[model samples]
Target: MGKRGGSSTKGWAQEPIGALRVGTVGPIADFDPDSTPGFDGDRRLGEELLTERGEVLAGLQELLFANGRAGDHRSVLLVLQGMDTAGKGGIVRHVGGLLDPQGLSVKGFGKPSPEELSHDFLWRIRKALPPAGRIGIFDRSHYEDVLPVRVHSLVPQSEWEARYDIINRFEHELVDTGTTIVKCALVVSKDEQKTRLAERLDRPDKYWKYNPGDLDERAYWDDYREAYQAIFDRCDSDASPWYMIPANRKWFSRLAICELLIDALSGLDLHWPAAEFDVDAEKKRLAALPD
Candidate 1:
């Protein structure tokens, strides 16, 4: 695809996660929902750009998969957290669809089941981790424990507050075991969210996706904002830093996430594995087989 306004590949890969990260200081209030951050392209062109980059994206995923198949025990986990209608599903459908399905795992976490609630919050998360040879995407993740739980008072403040340290340690353990975690928060403005929710209500095809409770949650927008600030303050870390993606524009959001994934994979030395057996001998053996 033709270049957009974003940083160069060389620069992006080397840039610290803090460049687009939110931590300690809460920038949500002052941050622009429509900010494109190194990208100036509009939705119309951004869609075409994503199409253009598809091949390269697939190729990079293949290299990562090949590395895993060749016995490299590393894998990638993309954790997507955002407000409702912020396009988590779109990321899975667009950006994630570029990868080989055989090597892709997507887990959508909803309300905890009775069984899930019985264990630690991370219990279900651990079960959803991708194997060494695949890419895993979480539609919503463990951060839900901190966000909605904290906002709705599902857990006491002391307990949810304590989860920050527990979560950091859990992520550290995951990294120590060869998982690279990429966390993204798709940020949309209150107005933008209202527009999206309205669209869902107005369209017959989208009616099934609408939930009355979304309105209830919207009432607590400020509360959730504060909860998110808390998450950024305590959870953003070197091992798994969070990228705040301005998602007012769906096309740009998808493109930005695609570029982010490409950059993350580029850091790894990925290559096609050399054949273990003699290629000529293997070819001859196959050639001699009966049709």
Candidate 2:
């Protein structure tokens, strides 16, 4: 919607040059998974920045929550889509961990259960939406319908192919009804994924985190890549744009996500809700009470 480059906006963080933002159609291969846009600092600097921004984000989130409770009736939705072990969990813990749990809703979409599969693809997503005045995080979101469903041919070509329009319309409806959607694709290189997966087996403490099935899916990396390319092509929009974040560096990935969210929430123009009750009268009443 705005200029496609590395520059600061009045209320939002500056996107770095080469950051892949889907608007019309473009090749995903142009974006390097190792590139850290807008952040040229090392991991140590990334950590410091994340900490500083985390505090600011917490305050903004509080304002958003207060405004919602005071009947503003708007919310923020962070839709995270990525291949397995792409640092989605780390982003959730590091960035989302800053917010008050009362105003946070985190949902992970895995393989649809029998009950979920029976309904429309977006049924669970719609149900899991963050209420007005809160932030919602989707560990993996409705995009799965387009990605794996197409990659694995779980649905007919005609069916999954048509989902792009469905998703676009669905996001537009959400925007109309007062939800701001920020979708991020954590881009981790295949080599990095292999390293992480191997470390999982090498360390006993990380055994539970290791999934044998992930290896099976690794075989379909190219398929998943193509699937993601299609998603960026079809679903990226001004209302709900997709951001491809280079996640090979976990610290940088976390910082970028926080920056994205901070930028989104900052644009909400949130304010602390005014007190509905008479402050002076309440103060007088309390002062007159016996201690």
Candidate 3:
């Protein structure tokens, strides 16, 4: 059998995360998801990407840990968006797995529940914000406030249209408070999506995910595309911008994300706090504890 696909080579190691920028996608050929090829049921193309992802993730952890020690804490809010089968959950599962669970939190936003709907769009989101020194991830994120709800006419065009400014201010506040916001939208082709849908249908365990409703949604592809374009156009600010990730190949997507996130966090002024206890007092305290 052909080797399971993801590359583990150092050549494919993550680029400096700072190298990525919104409105600056260097080459569709270079970063397109189709470049990644999977083997069997696995997106084996993530092999090298996963390795790089792991390293960068470790780097993020180190920074957070140092911040924790120094009491000069920083927080990160990572937002993920993509069409269905774009690997949002998988990225969370694998990329997030590298983090200390205590320091990482994940939230997946679906349609607004009654309670969530009752409140303003950003209300439910604020509740999930990470405290200082931790990482918080939003799987579908508040961007949907501007995208699907607007595209599908799920809400008033006037209400959803106003959210761009609201989102920009909300994220700017996070950045102002020493929180870094990393946002990405995973992109995939209709053909690739169909293949994945076939896999879901063929597998018994995945049957629950087979939504005929998705076909109806697929008909609105152009609307979703326009919505995403508007999302990037308006909400892509200096404080927080959207990174459009090609997701045909899961490998490139993972590495791209790892690089972007790690880059954002690499050089923050992180450190361990100086210890204040007197040596003798600490020694005595330890001595008194359990002889």
Winner by TM-score? 2
TM agreement with the true structure for every prediction: 0.90, 0.92, 0.84
When 1 and 2 are scored with TM-score, the better candidate is 2
For model 3, the stretches where C-alpha displacement exceeds 4 angstroms are: 1-20, 26-31, 35-46, 52-56, 287-291
Please list the C-alpha lDDT of all candidates, in the order they appear: 0.81, 0.83, 0.73
Q: Which tens-of-lDDT digit does each residue in 1-291 have in candidate 1?
A: 222223334323333244467752247776677876655456776777687666667777777788788998888899999999989999999998888898899999999999999999999999999999688999999999999999998988899989999999999998899888889998889999999999999999999989999989999999988888777777788778788888898887787787777666766657777887899999999999999
Clashing pairs in 2: none
Lowest lDDT block of 10, candidate 1: 2-11
Residues 113-155, model 2: lDDT tens digits:
9999999999999999999999999999999999888988999
Instruction: Tell me how many residue pairs clash in candidate 1.
Output: 0
TM-score (C-alpha) between model 3 and the true structure: 0.84
Clashing pairs in 3: 6-44, 6-47, 7-48, 33-248, 33-249, 69-273, 70-273
Sorted on lDDT, highest at the top, how do the candidates line up?
Answer: 2, 1, 3
